[model samples]
Target: MRVLVVGGEATIGRHVSAELRRRGHVVVTAGRSSGDVRVDVRHRDSVADMYREIGGVDAVVAPAAHGTTDRLQTLSRDELLQNMQGKLLGQVDLVLLGQHHAAAGASFTLTSGIFADEPWPGVTGGAMINAALHAFVRSAALELPRGMRVNVVSPTMVGDSVDSFSSTFPGMRPVPMDALVTGYLSVIEGERTGEVVRAYG
Candidate 1:
């Protein structure tokens, strides 16, 4: 499979991309500042341009999502919009625009996190968008054409990055990187659509 992984250089993205490549898949990585191609999902034009540059692929995996983490009350209007554009609308547009560029039977694997269900403080915007993605996948899968499939991977905080996020997700058990990647593999290789492939408890 020719897989295009956006944000393939990030902590989690690298692991997912590497595992896919190790499995004998053709992985083409893209990101804001890194990867084989440059794409900032926050903008629709960038995503559209990215599809044109790549032409076609069997799969598009996004392990990247950008958003603000401030408290809902303290988060300014600009910050709220930034969060929506980055995490919510960005991936939403990625799938919406990518549908036209996808090959027959192509698949899209989007990234959401555990916050959707278990919201910690200061994750209002991210949590809302993550939950919205679940509904988006459930509905979009029914309408996408040419046998295209879409699923969102909702992963837990990775053990590798536990130190960085332990404060935000206090007392929670961080999932191992190996186990988290299975969420992507399930949707990428299995016959599942409109599903939220949870990567941890």
Candidate 2:
């Protein structure tokens, strides 16, 4: 499969990209600054441009974080909108515009987080956006044409990410990196749609 991974420069996206390539899939990593193509998923035009540049692919994986980490009360309106545009609407734009570029029955795998189900300080906005991604997958999957499918991977902080977010998840165990990667593989390589594939350690 020709897979496109937006934000494949670091963290989860990096791991996912490596695994896919190791499995013999043609993986293309894209971001605002680096990768086989340049794309900023927050903007529809950029996403459109990315698809145009790369032509069509069989799958698109977005294992990236683009949300603010501030308490809801303290978050300004601008911050909130930016988070929405960066996280929720950004991935949505991928699916919306990608339908025209991807091959038939193509799959879209998006990244959300454990916050959607479990709360943590200063993560209210992220939680909301994560939950919204789940909702979007459920509804969009039903309406997608040409057998296209959409799913979200809501994973707990894993491995290297533990140090950065451990404060928020007091007793939360960092999910194994392999488990999170597996969740994405199942969604992109398997037949499931509208599913929230979760990985927790």
Candidate 3:
């Protein structure tokens, strides 16, 4: 399988990329940083260029997005729109544009966080964007063509990055990065679509 993983330099993205490669699939990573493909999902032209460069892929997983932790009252219009543009509309457009670029039966897995339903204060942007993303995935699943499958991975705050925001999640399960990798694999390899695989409690 030729897999294109967006945001491949991030901690979870790196782990998922490595896991896919270990399974003997050829992995091509893309991000704003070092990658075979470079595209800021926030820009439509950049994303289109990325697909052109990669030509066709068996699967495309976007584990990259921009989200912020700010109280709703404190968030500026810029901050709120930034989250909506990148986390919600960015992936939505990616699917719309990428449909023609992916091979028949190709899979697309998007990233969301557990904050969608398990909300926390100061994370209103993340929570709203996450919920919208899941809804987008469910709708896209029904409309996508050519046997293409679309799903979202709503992972909890990962253990590796727990130090950054561990306090935000008091009793929530902090999933190991490895366990999240399995969820991505399930989306890619399984017969299911139109699903949000919650990789944590």
Candidate 4:
């Protein structure tokens, strides 16, 4: 199978890409940096260009996004939009535009986080975007044509990176990146759609 993994430069995206490649699938990993192609999820044109370059693939996985980490009061409207633009809306656009370029029955797996259901002070933007993305996947699943599938993977902070987000993720259990990749593989290979698979819970 051919897979296009967006934001494959670091963290979960990197692991997901490597795992897919290890499984003997043809994987094209893309990020803002050098790759087979460049994709800024914030822009629809960039997503389109990536598909154009890769031609059609069997699946698209997005494991990267950006968002503000400030409290709601400190978050400017622009900061909120920045999160929505890159993480929420951009991934949505990826699916909407991807339908045109993906092979029939193609699968799309998006990334969300524990914030969708869990609460953390100073993480209002992430919470909002994560919840919205799950909603988008549910609705998109029903309307997608030609057996295409859409799903969201909501993972908790990685156990390996707990130190970097210690302040924000106080007391939260970090799931390993390898564990989270299981959710991605589930979405890609299973016949499921419209589901938000939580890696921790």
Q: Which stretches of candidate 4 lie over 4 Å from their true place?
A: none
lDDT of each residue in 1-201, candidate 4, tens digit only? 899888876788888889898889898888888567888878888888888888999999998765668777678888888778889888998899999999999999998888889988888889989999999999999999999999999988887688898677688888987888888998888899999999983
TM-score of model 1 vs. true structure? 0.96
Ordered from best to worst lDDT, the candidate numbers read 2, 4, 1, 3
TM-score of each: 0.96, 0.96, 0.95, 0.96
* Candidate 2: tens digits of C-alpha lDDT, residues 108-154: 99989888998888888889889999999999999999999999998
Model 3: per-residue Cα lDDT over 84-147, one tens digit each: 8778888887799889999999999998888898868788888888999999899999989999
User: What would the TM-score be for candidate 4 when compared with the true structure?
Assistant: 0.96
lDDT of each: 0.87, 0.89, 0.86, 0.87
Clashes of each: 0, 0, 0, 0
Clashing pairs in 3: none
lDDT of candidate 1 over 64-158, digit per residue (tens): 67555787667777877787887888899889999999888999898888889996888887888899999999999999999999999988788
Task: State in Å the error of residue 6, model 4.
Answer: 0.2
Decide which is better by TM-score, 3 or 4.
Answer: 4
Off by over 4 Å in 2: none
Model 3 residue 92 distance off true place after TM-score fit, in angstroms: 1.4
